[model samples]
Target: MKNLVFNKLEPGTNIPYELLLLADETVEAINQYIFDCAVYLLNDGLQNIAVMALHPNSNTELEIKNIAVIESYRSQGIGSILMGKAKEIAKENSCTILTVGTSDTGFQQIRFYEKNGFVKKGIRKDFFTDNYPFPIYENGLQMRDMIILSHDLSE
Candidate 1:
């Protein structure tokens, strides 16, 4: 973890737009949080490898708006690092729960969150079809619902 450096990106400044698009498909989708939410960029000193966007939903909860690691740098424990950082931040802010929503078809993402201590709580049906202008696909399956997962920060 010490090898990874995290920085809170400043608004109205340089944001890795291309890197963000890797996690969220549409520019319109990213526009929902890119400007207002807090964006954290993780770099390995050599390159900007990952980014996570956080949105504080309430005094006791926060949502992971977006979390993505570069294609080549994935599966290398980077996403976990970002998650840990998010947990730490939630604790500091006195938030009790950290939540994330992903496509129902995102099997890898579901596994990833569960492995990191998050549990499935609820789901939003037709989230993708209703939000995006076009259909979204993952693993050859058309994404239709959003699976909501949460972890207790107090634990």
Candidate 2:
């Protein structure tokens, strides 16, 4: 936990993108949005431990494109730390809503986001089946739809 610095990764800076691929399964999918999104990194002075991708969907909304923490760092409050920063950044950027979309199979993620104040907004039908080239599965369940969650940044 020492020297754990978290901040937005500036453009043209050397960033270890492999850390992002950990959360998002495909390079193609990530590449489609990487440049358009803002990359925030969590590092311990020596190595990368977590990453969160945020993108502006509109003047009043920001979308969490992806969030991932290394296995060894998971459940150690790093993710929550990133969420805390995300909310702050959203407010600073004048965005009123923060949203993230996860697959229907993401029970743990749903709980985590809900615990952090996000509420279910809507669902994107066949999102996984249409987007991912290969079948996506988790916990022995096939991921079919994308459940979108939103948090009001107006507070």
Candidate 3:
């Protein structure tokens, strides 16, 4: 974890307002509690991505709240590495699970999480309706819900 750099995006600066509309307090609290948001620079051997706001869900679970990678640096397995690190940290702490929420804007992320072995557990209806500037769409379909995805670290 020491080698990874975590950066917090300014409350309303880095993240889209639509996202904040739904989870502002959660983000605020995470910014205050987490030591750092992890980032892997692009200049350093082709790995440029950031993972931020890791927080404890409880004694047995940890949440991966935010992850971002530069568009040019994406699809090169950087995200997988970040998720691996999160899993490692959770396992080290005896955490049983890892959880993350994806907005309707997180179109590609939905598949990424499932590809990494995460399963859908629930949904928040109309989650991004008020947050995204434009309507959210998936496969030409409008997204009107937020899905909760989880991976079991203990298994």
Note the Cα lDDT for every prediction shown: 0.91, 0.91, 0.63
Q: Predict model 3's lDDT versus the native.
A: 0.63
With a 3 Å backbone cut-off (N, CA, C), the pairs that clash in candidate 2 are: none
Those runs of model 3 whose alpha carbons end farther than 4 Å from true positions after fitting are 1-48, 130-143
Candidates 2 and 3 compared by TM-score, better number: 2
Q: Identify the leading candidate in terms of lDDT.
A: 1
Worst 10 residues of 3 by lDDT: 39-48
- Give a tens-digit lDDT track for model 3, residues 1-155: 23444333454345432332232334443444444433222233333244444678788988776665555546887678778777887898789999888765566888999999899888889866755556656568776777899998767
Number of clashes in model 1?
Answer: 0
After superposing candidate 2, which stretches have Cα over 4 Å from the reference? none
Which residue pairs overlap in candidate 1's backbone?
none
lDDT of 1 by residue, 92-150 (tens): 99999999999999999999999999999999999999999898889999999999999
Q: Write the per-residue lDDT of candidate 2 for residues 49-118, one digit (tens) a residue.
A: 9999999999999999999999988999898998998999999999999999998999999999999999
Model 2 sits at a Cα RMSD from the real structure of 1.1
Model 1 scores what on Cα lDDT? 0.91
Measured against the true structure, the TM-scores of the candidates, in listed sequence, are 0.96, 0.96, 0.65
